[model samples]
Target: MKQIKIGVFGCNRGGDYFRSLLANNADIVAVCDKDDFWLNKAKKRLGDGVAYYASFDEFIEHPMDAVLLANYFNEHAPFAIRCLEKGIHVLSECTAAGTMAECVQLVRAAEKSKAKYMLCENYPFMKFNREIKRICDSGTLGKILYAEGEYNHPVASSDVAFMRKYKPYAEHWRNYLPRTYYITHSMAPIMYATGANPIRVTALPVFAPFDDSMAISGSHCGDRAAIITTLNDDDSVFKVSGCAGFGAHGNSYRVCGTEGQIENLRGMGTQVMLRYNKWSKPAEMESNNLYDPKWNHKDEALIEKEGHGGGDFLVIQEFLNCILEDKKPPFDVYFATRMSAVAILAHRSLLELGMPYDIPDFRKEEDRVKWESDFLTPFYGPNGEAPTLRCSSHADFTPPEGPMKAYLEAIKTRE
Candidate 1:
């Protein structure tokens, strides 16, 4: 098979999956990023003959079979649409689009273009998660009824300030985002574990205190958010939480079914527990906790090394295989768009005081038309995409300027 030439955007995050691409049926042709520091570093570390561009406009014009969209979080949709127009396949990072309207446009673009698109959501590829998928798919955990996923990464005031100030571009999406929008990490795994489509979405925001540093950093967006989603297949429900102000440091998940259930190690190191239900009152369920290498037989390196338990590498490899073999990726554009679209409606539900919103089935043509013109958002981009900083969690709160100044001073000292 011939090697597919690939160009990666956002060198900072781009570097994480480089080895994986290089190891697969692909060639690293170029990398693009405005951050000269990381850009120069990646160019040097990867050696000579590899083109590097500071401008995305010029980078897209480079000859390549595919492009990796690791740019700022909310900018992938527009960039991917342009790439598809250019007839280049796309492998995007997280949360497919910033708004529902963009989601519609993105789906339509991929539908028309010959090039394919895959959202590189890595959490679902984690060793435990993959095992959960296998067990559920095998019907060992028969008829999944409920699931839970959580991602809590609390940061100090200084790091949060620096992130708000000097990170990426001036109007970085993370700086002004609805808490529910960053739901991909916590929610994608459950969706992948079971092939369930979210039919309805409702959310409750975890409000931050007035004195919280995040509130000071122009993020009145809740410190965290809880989303309750009802699935289309069996009407199953999934509870997902993300960005909790202060809580556990990593990701965790749990799946419950009729025959058995499995849960992440969580605070218990690297072990996971598998339990089976019994009707006897004295012995209702059996539990086992240990690491079984057999669970990740498909890719042992992923469980032994690399980032996110080696999931970082596995997801990239899957994308490349799809491109090389002319196969559809595991997480295709439609499924990925649903992930982002559900988050958009979940935020809407929060704004309406936890009221439920029906998640439009984008698979149906009529459903896409209903939301074709619905792309408005509270948080904005350089293009006036949104106009508010606060979602429903906090009222009358504005992102403070004091932290911004402090963040600027800290970066200036470093320079």
Candidate 2:
């Protein structure tokens, strides 16, 4: 296949995956970031010949087949829409749209443009989760009754590097968002492995003191919330805690089917224990070496060495395969919306003091019009476009300024 020329936005996080693509399937023609530090880093790491841009407008003008958006979390939707409108393919990161309104618009944009839109949700590609998906689909677990997924990262206290780097941006609404807003990381795997559609979700925010403290510290917003979701033919419960103030680090999930249960083992990276009522208490178990080989069997050993537990490389590899084969990606726009839409609805439930909410189907074209004009994110103009940061909000909120404060200022100036 001819090499696909691409522009990668958000240099820091974009570096690894962009480099992986360069090493495997594509050419990194251009790179962009608001921060000079990342731009310089990308230059050093990806080589000097690649063009780099500091501004989004300038980056979009570069000739490229696709745009890999590794920009801000809340900003992905508008940027993806713009790229699609310009006839460029887009691969966006997690919680694809910050709000339900943007969710509808994003899907419509993809449908109209006929350009490939893929959600880079790496957790589903993790070896343990991939194995579970294989087994569950193989009919070994029987009908899935319930499952739980979590990305309960204590980001505030765990790592000093990110805390210091993002101190300024962390002070804003994008940083101190509602508790339920982060549900995708902790919830996507179950949805991916089980193929169950969540019909209704009742989300109750945990108003414990830990969350209140984080809010006061200008770190996180409300406390963590528990989502009681009823799937199409099954039921499940998912809870996630992502405060700088509390909880453990990393992502994990558990699946309980009518005949068995599977869980990611604690402490050991990527190990899991499968149990069943039909067999012994510890039905089966595996760790480390045995783990990676399960999923790596499909690709070369070199590709296996590339990503987060083999996931990062797989996501990139799949994106390239879909392009070459003229096929829709497994994690296409419809499923991507399914994985992220609950977070938006869950946030609504928190605002209503944990009222149950039904997630709307964006796949049905009829539902698109109801929310096209609604902009749910704290930022964004009524027309669903990015706005300029005003003088009062122009100051960069790196590490020390905190994310909550930076977030509010962002809404005031740019929203």
Candidate 3:
């Protein structure tokens, strides 16, 4: 067995994968983060065997075959590009690019690199979601037509602790994140299950700012969620949320086809509900059947011990398998960039009051030419470049001064 050497960037989220990487027989060669707290945490877990660095410039110079990018939500593309430039494999977390130009740059970098790039999107590997894909692939669902996914996570207004930890500073990316930005959790599973690529996207915002009296929030966007709709290459339509904060906290998905429909039961753990017309129900199956899914994976024990319904473990396993086998990952650079395009354009649609935007196919030179110079972004740059665009549907919306002050105070107390 060839042990793949891997380094991780951003220990805060990247450290979560240390055990999984070790379980898959990958050597933890190096780890890097700007924060001493996170770097020290990684040191504690990986022991003194791994080299640690506080500067990414020096970290990337370390000898490693691949790098797992679990950095900030909006800053993966530039780092991934640098890795690809060095012929280092990349397993990126979540949305691949923060802007259209970065999307173009990422595609170009991957095309020119010998090493592969994969989006570490784990939602598709969830037990029930995998079952949904199985049923879809089995032809029991007939021709897939429409699907829906919702990732609702609503924190309590009084959870100042969360604000202190995640949104520690006013200029943090999370503080300025649009409702449609954190989209992969709700978008990837349906795309994987149905084999659909989004061609067009539009969205509407669910605007409901938190009460300043109860919550200490520094988030610039007041929208609770973005209801995004996509028209796919397969003629199927997908409706999903972008990290919603509405109703109850749950991750739900549904796939409806010509003959039948299936959905994972929210608040019911791994159980799924499958339904079909009497004439369309398959043999030995009821018109309406509900059951919990079985893992049936070789790494079931190790997977069960991990997070995200065991998806975290499977994602690492798949990435390593791809590397060792000299195969491209299913969630390749193209797939990742496409998802980022949908997210970026969906937010544009929300700002435009639901004006649809065509998703460009970066594989086409014409499409790449169209967006190569489009660098508009809603995030502050590392050098403090101001955002070129607004993040919220309400362009003038900002957290009240009282809440902002309280939020800063809470973070200071934590320090």
Candidate 4:
């Protein structure tokens, strides 16, 4: 077997990808991290055969066929673009990029690069989601008219304190991202199901009035936000996401078509419902529960012990296959641009008070070039003006009381 040499950036979240890579017996040539704490840990886990580097510049020079970008959610694009420019394939852990400009640059870079780029959105590869996609693609549900996806994550106060403790930098992307920015986990699956991209979006964010978190963390952004999106190729309106401190524990999705519908069960069960017109010529209606099913052995050899319901396994396998076969990944640069643009436009819609914002087709050169100069991000430059709009009320930040403050006092990392 030809061992495809791979390097990974960001070893913390990179663990899952490493495990998946190991399953395929890929040659783990290198790993990189900004922090010595993480880099040292990765070296211990990956062994002496795999090289480690604190600087990405050094790691990029190391021999590798592909790079798994499991870095900061806001900072994948620049690194991925570099890898592609160097003729190294890249599989990005999503949001794809931070700003519209990065999205535009990413698309343009991949278009010119010989190496392939893929957005590793694991949600669509989940057991139920794949089943839904198969059913929809089979035309069993007719035209998918409406769909809903929600990822409401409640970050505990302690977790906030811990993140602040380790990464005390003021501009750390995780600390202050608006609830609306991380909508890809929910939105990507819906896009995958219908093979459609959201054309425009309207966003509304609900500010959390929790006094403890507000007094402790000073998060001006909301605890929950919702975005309604219209698909371009299909007449489907997708209710995409509500995120951050929404006091919710799980994620779920549903799509209703002209003929039928499919939805996951509420609560802590893996039950799902599938309703459709039976394929038989009798024109009969059928309803079936999708649970306790047989295993899908499509990528049996490579994706056996994968994460995200074998999605992590499948996505990496596809990336490898695309590299070997010299084909574009299913979720290539265009798809990444579209998904990232949804959040970008959604946040813009919130700035305009739920007004609709148009999502440009980045596949077009003109549409992309116009956004090339737009470097809007959650973090600000030395100049007082940050991005186009500051999501937080306080431009200057103060560490919150209790644990976060104690961490600041005890161990100061950055900023």
Name every residue pair that clashes in candidate 3: none
The TM-score ranking, best first, is 3, 1, 4, 2
TM-score of each: 0.90, 0.82, 0.98, 0.88
Residue 167, model 2: Cα distance from true site in angstroms: 3.6
User: lDDT tens digits, residues 96-139, model 4?
Assistant: 88889999889888889988899987877776777778777978
What range of 10 consecutive residues in model 1 has the weakest lDDT sum?
A: 280-289
Which candidate should be chosen as best, given TM-score against the real structure?
A: 3
Instruction: By lDDT, rank the candidates, best first.
Output: 3, 1, 4, 2
| Candidate 2 stretches greater than 4 Å from native | 156-160, 170-174, 208-217, 224-230, 233-245, 279-293, 298-300, 378-415
* Poorest 10 consecutive residues by lDDT, candidate 2: 389-398
Kindly report the root-mean-square deviation of model 3 from the true structure over all alpha carbons: 1.0
Output the worst ten-in-a-row residue range by lDDT, candidate 4: 406-415
Most lDDT-accurate candidate: 3
Which digits, one per residue and each the tens of the lDDT, describe model 3 over residues 44-76?
A: 888988999999999999999999999888899
